[model samples]
Target: MRTALNLRLFLAAVIATAVALVATAVVLNFLFRLYFEDRLRDELETYLIQLSGNVAVTDSGEVEVGPLADPRFNNPLSGYYWQIEVAGADPVLSPSFWGAPMALERPEQPGVIRVQDINIGTEEPLAVAHWVILTGQDAAQRSLHLAVALDRTDLDVSVAGFRLNSTLWLAVLGAFLLIASAVQIRLGLRPLEKVRSEVNRVSRSPAGRLSDDYPTEVLPLVEEVNQLLDTNAATLERVRAGAGNLAHGLKTPLTILHGVERKLRKAGQDLLADELQTEIASIEHIVERELARHRDSGQSRQVCEVAPVVRRLSDALSQQPGSEQIRWSVEVDERLRAPFDEFDLTELVGNLLDNAMKWTDGRIVVRGALSGTVASLTVCDDGPGLSDAGHEIVLGRGRKADPERSGTGLGLSIADEMAQAHGCALTLDRSDMGGLSVMLAWEQAEAAPR
Candidate 1:
């Protein structure tokens, strides 16, 4: 649910650090308390031994204990309290003990010293322990226990005070850390923000470009986009210029020719009428050819399924003159597709098969193959195919092998040019159908936008 990228990462790190700090504090407090208790118990044991050494039995069966010369060691008000219990019929002890019973955990358990909570006096909460020892008086062995305690009320108050200040500091530090992290997030994303702004700027019109001012990571997309724009621009310019030149070249000549014809008619000369008609026919052919070229060039290459084109072209060829007389057949993998413009596809196949129908009387065959990023289209006919000279001339620009040949005759040349433009090639070979074979191969581009 947390949408900020840097904040999420920073918070995760901070939480982890806080958890580690709490764990460390707990471990250190445990160790520190343990060391402190051990030192306290050691002092208590030393005091018990000193008090026991002061005990005297003067061989009169009279027992006497401390009223020592060590003034510093005699104070019970030093937050150090003790209870020496000497086992006897009625052993008397210090009246300094006022309230709160010292709890000896696991009764009769004796050792160096240990810490425990005890009731020492009214409103008094003391951490206490006892040290037990044996005394030898002739044949009598007497047990004595020295109980020492400290008032923990003051220490608890100091610890609680320290905790209060630490909590406030932790809150201030956490706020400062969050603020710094937010600033860092903004700084880190600044470059991406600039890229977004530039993108917005470029989106206004077709003249836009991905700018060169970008991080290295974004350069490839910029370069590919620029290449596409440049290529499209060049193509558009070429098309515009070609259209203008074609209009001027064709329309002006036709207009002048019309004027000359008008003058001839006005002069009453029927002499060169047939020649004039032939010139008009020639002009019409040029006009139709260029028009077809313009239409075909505008047909962009696209990823088109090849089987359908083959079927369509084959069926059309079957309806052509002398086509049904020749058996027709098509073989193409149904899944195969090609990078082809619709007009080029028609022009390419139509030319090859039309030329084939010229002589093929038995059968015509069409095959479409897809292989390793390349599409190969084969069109073959069984008629008496092209002569070596005729075959070469058939595909040449505006050149018909026999001067007697008819038709606009730009089919093969146009197919070649279209193939080149689409990053494909054309090949000629002998068909197994016993005629000339023509193959068109091209690399198809993907339809998806990068």
Candidate 2:
């Protein structure tokens, strides 16, 4: 499964802590068991020494037993026991054994100590043995073996309690360590979160750049990003300068062609003069359209207020020769702004409004509104509208819906280009004013109305 860096690190640390704690608990429990076994052997050795000091053998081979200091040795099957055996006599057993005998092993040689684990009937016990030689009356010698043993219950209980407590504490300690690791991971990655937010703001703001307030490890990356943005800005400026130079260079040839047309008319070649005039007009239209696009690219980006641009274009179109006979009206929110440069907005509105003034018979209306982050502009006229197919053809460059209309086909095409430059949708439909309606819709860049 996929996992984030912080979560993966946390899980790794927690698993490692859990495994280490578990291993520590196991090792400590094992060591405690070994220590407890050694303690049982030591206690058995002390009992062995006590029994040997008080034991005796008579000349007639009778075994004599004595009282021991520990009261546990006197109680039958009290989990404590002792036994003594001579060369060929019956074995002596502690009172703790009751009538049951312990199967304690003898030492191989005199004064040699032996330790083992054996079962007294069904119970397991630790057994330690010592061998010696005893002298009786007349200098006769007899062999003696002494041993002590106890059950494993007390040792088991002690080791079990130590393991339980150690595990509990270690587990609690592991939990705290995991929590600390989580906190450390969060603190370490906080700077990265800040960088992500700043990068988003840069994309949304035209003049925004990455901030330098970052850790040493991240500072180099931030500097590189800022450099890239600066380089891009310089490249766009050079491109715009080149386009402007080319446009001015072409205008000179167009001016010379106009002079030739006038000279041809003065030479009495009227037919050739008219043809050159039409060609010059066509070339001028192409130049104007290209210049409009160039301006769109060169203009500085800003929030273009819709109301002022619409009113200014409406007033300018009203002054045109044919437009004086028609009424012009504009309705737009004063606070509404589009995410476009001012010159681009002017070109888009001027082209559409100019076309409306040329076609409308009585009245022309321009309306604008803001809906959420989207802005919509509509221009309508009371003249005859186009069919669906005709509207489609009008959107194409150099294609006029009605050739009889006294205008070049560049108007609607230029407006369409501007809409596409701003990443907008331009569509045509019949208006309620019993005429053609053109609408433009685009997303706004600003958060507020202004």
Per-residue lDDT of candidate 1, residues 157-193 (tens digit): 6555655655566667667776676677677666667
TM-score for all predictions?
A: 0.43, 0.69
Which clashing pairs does model 1 show?
99-120, 99-121, 100-119, 100-120, 101-119, 359-383, 360-383
Which ranges of candidate 2 are over 4 A from the true structure? 1-3, 31-68, 85-91, 98-145, 250-383, 403-426, 436-450
User: Using TM-score as the measure, which candidate wins?
Assistant: 2
The C-alpha lDDT values of all candidates are 0.64, 0.78
Across 220-327, the per-residue lDDT of candidate 2 in tens digits comes to: 988998887787657656766876787688879978987898799899998998798777767766776776676666333445678888888787777778566788
Q: Using alpha carbons, what is the TM-score of model 2?
A: 0.69
- lDDT score of model 2? 0.78
Name the 10 consecutive residues with the lowest summed lDDT in model 1. Answer: 89-98
